[model samples]
Target: MFPITADWMSFVIVALATLFLIGELLVSTKGIFSILGLGFITIYFASFLDPGMFFVMIIIYFFGLILMIIDGKILNDGTLAVIGLVCMFVSVGFTAPNMVAGLYAVIGVFIGGISSFAFLKVFKKRQMWTKITLFDQLTEEAGYSSINQSYKELVGKRGITTTDMRPIGTVMIGDEEYSAITQGKWVAKDTEVEVMDVDGTKILVKDSEKLQKKSAD
Candidate 1:
């Protein structure tokens, strides 16, 4: 009865940790929840058992941590699921041979560390693949009137063109992008253009003249 109770508690601890770790992944609140979850599982495992059982629990805890980090950082969802199943098999299978306990623990930690490193490298590469843009002097209002606020009123307002325009294009103001006709015609690519008139999304501006004025002011 006592052994069964302990087992149940251990299971609960592990289950809660796993769920919390999963939550950390979905909700991107940084790794706070995940670290908490790991702590819970570690305490539960380490506190409730005898030396032998404690050692085993430690192995399982570290194994689970590695699995989670790999899941989050390296493997896609499907692949992580598969790895989870495999880890379960390993944890369960190692129970029979007490002599090889240390080996199992070492192996689990090694797999986890390697997978985590790989995940970090992949994440860095992904960041490199993305492009970031900045726009200044935007308005929170809507429609042509809002456009006017950003352009005519915001004589020194700066904005980014969302779409390409032969001479006319779209510029962002606050949270809204306005249609702006260029001040001196053709505005190419992501060239920083200024707001001249607020017709609507229709904004009129030369290349960065208004931005310059805003900076001077």
Candidate 2:
């Protein structure tokens, strides 16, 4: 069923491989999945390589994992993540028992990434990505509150741009400051604007003077 011609055994092997390896990233299995992942990956490599090369390939695979952690935690850019994937694919392809196993391993990694999404719902993610992902919505202390029905009241109100709205900026509506955006228009600071829409906390606005001029003409 894999891209390459994988036998029934290859299916079982890749499933366990991805399960433990990718599963570890998804939830905090507390070293359990790590141990299982290492064991399965070792078995997959041992089927084809000598003791010397087997250890080398294992190191490369873990190195790829380290890069992924760096990408997720430190850099937050995707550069390390891509490099890490290439490293892992190379390790698997080079050490697999046959062409079929190599393809299966690569496919397994992809499925594992997709499957990781499921963990976010059921499990508490303690990973670094959690810190950067929608933290404002997670807590009110960080200055993020759910958009209440009252926000609709200001939809037609006029305001002044507190900052340059290069599409997204802040505007002051009456005495309250709100984060708002323009309709793909560049608005300068201190310029007058009118709220056009409020979808939850997303406030969309347009230049009030431009609207007035258009209405007058």
**Which of the numbered candidates is closest to the native, going by highest lDDT?**
2
lDDT of 2 by residue, 89-176 (tens): 7887776667776777777666655666676677766665566554445445765556655787898999999999999999999999
Model 1 scores a C-alpha lDDT of 0.53
- The lDDT for every candidate, in the order shown, is 0.53, 0.77
How far is each candidate from the true structure, as Cα RMSD in Å?
14.9, 7.5
Residue by residue across 118-214, what tens digits does model 1's lDDT show? 4343332233112321213344642224444434675557767777767767777567776767655777666677655556545566778545787
Model 2 spans > 4 angstroms off = 1-8, 127-134, 138-142, 145-217
- Residue pairs in collision within model 2: none
